[model samples]
Structure formats: structure tokens, C-alpha cells
Target: MTDHLGSCLCGTVKFEVHGQFDSFYLCHCEWCQKDTGSAYAANLFSQSAKLAWIAGVDAVTSFTLPGTRHSKSFCKLCGSALPSIQVAGLLVVPAGCLDIEITMLPTAHIFTSSKAAWGQGLRDVPEFGGLPH
Candidate 1:
């Protein structure tokens, strides 16, 4: 099992996820897009893994979509996404919240029917390491 360290954007919340992720998904569901404010939400899923809060656990807050199983946890201060324990023994970790580099690639793209049109076919767009001049 591998251990990954992560923190909130304001560094108010810190945690470690211990064990291998069973799968990684890039979800284009409208809910995911709304929560992440992006074209898709990248998440790692695990059933056998565990979460340990290293600091500021009290700063973590979660919200579940009304009448749905969808839920998200984030830092109360910075509002950055954090790890969450979903129902049915599933653990979810946002891919971008980790402090260390991850080698695991996404297993699939889900809810593609809700995908945004403006986000498509961007592979041919210009690439830059930073803001363009």
C-alpha cells in the first residue's frame, strides 16, 4: 500500500491516504462540473484504503447533493476539495489535492453525456508553461 500526503489550498487541513486506489475517474457530470468549476472532476477511488487526518480536521466540511449520493468535502477556509468518504464503503480523493506526484492515470471518463461542448477538442490548442505573453 502507498501513502499519499495532501493539504488544503490554505494549508489549514492536512491528511494522508494510505493504500492503493482501485480506480481513477474523470467525471463530466453536471454536478461534478458545478462542484469543481471545471470541465471535469478528476477523482481517485478506493475501497480498501483509509484516511487519516493529520491536522485541522475540524476545518473540513462536507455537503451532499439533495436526494442524491453525490457528496464533496472541502476546507472551510479555502474551499479547496479534499478527501471524502462516500456511502457504500467508497473513499474519494481529489487528484489535484495531493502534495506528491501521482503516477496513476485515470481509469475512465464517466457521465460523458453531460460533457461540456466548449471543453472538447482542446488537444490542438497552444500549450504554455505559464501565462502567455
Candidate 2:
């Protein structure tokens, strides 16, 4: 029963997950790209893990994509992505929100058929420790 702590970017919400993740995924779905404003969303899924809100639970807000099961939760103040409880007892936690380091690698890249054209060959791009001058 490993425990992981997480917080929103503005420190408005804090939470903990007490159990191991079942899987990790990098989703390239269009809604994921639009909501994240990035090529994909890095998420961890757990079926048996328990989630606890340590603080500022009211600061969290969620949205579901109309008729789709796709849903996301974020901090109202900073708008940073947080954890969400999906259908069938699935807990989806954004990897970026975790305060502690995660040892698990992504289980797979999902929705690859919708991968962005600009998302390819990212490894070939120049790496910088910080923003390039």
C-alpha cells in the first residue's frame, strides 16, 4: 500500500492516494489535447487505491465532455489538473500533479491514431535545462 501525495499548482488543493496504480497512460485523444493544451495527458489509473483530500477540497472543480465519459478535475484557483474518479471505480490521477516521484513508467500510449503531427520525433528536439534564451 504505497502512498502518494499531490497538490494543485497554486497549492489550493492537496490530496493523497493510498495504493499502487494499476496502469499509466499517455492519452493522445483530441479532447485530452484540447484540455491539457499539450500533445497528450499523462495519467495513472488505479482500481483499488483510496483517495483522500487533505485540504481545499472545495477548490476543486470538474468537467465532463458532454456525452462522453471523458472528465477532468482541476483546481479552481490555478486550474492545474488533478485527480478524478471515473466510472466503474476507476481513479485517474494526472502524473504531473503528484508531489512525490513515481517509479512506474507509462503502460502505453493510447489513442495513437489521433496523435498530433507535431508530437512525433520529440526526442530529436533540442533539450534545455530551462527556457532557452
Mind giving the per-residue lDDT tens digits that candidate 1 earns over 45-119? 999999999999999999999999999999999999999999988999999999999899999999999999988
lDDT of 2 by residue, 1-133 (tens): 8999999998989999999999999999999999899999999999999999999999999999898998999999999999999999899999999999989989999999999999999999999999999
Q: Give the TM-score of candidate 1.
A: 0.98
What lDDT score goes with residue 11 in model 1? 97
Q: Which stretches of candidate 2 lie over 4 Å from their true place?
A: none
In candidate 1, stretches whose alpha carbon ends up further than 4 angstroms from where it belongs are none
Per-model lDDT: 0.96, 0.96
Candidate 1 global CA lDDT score: 0.96
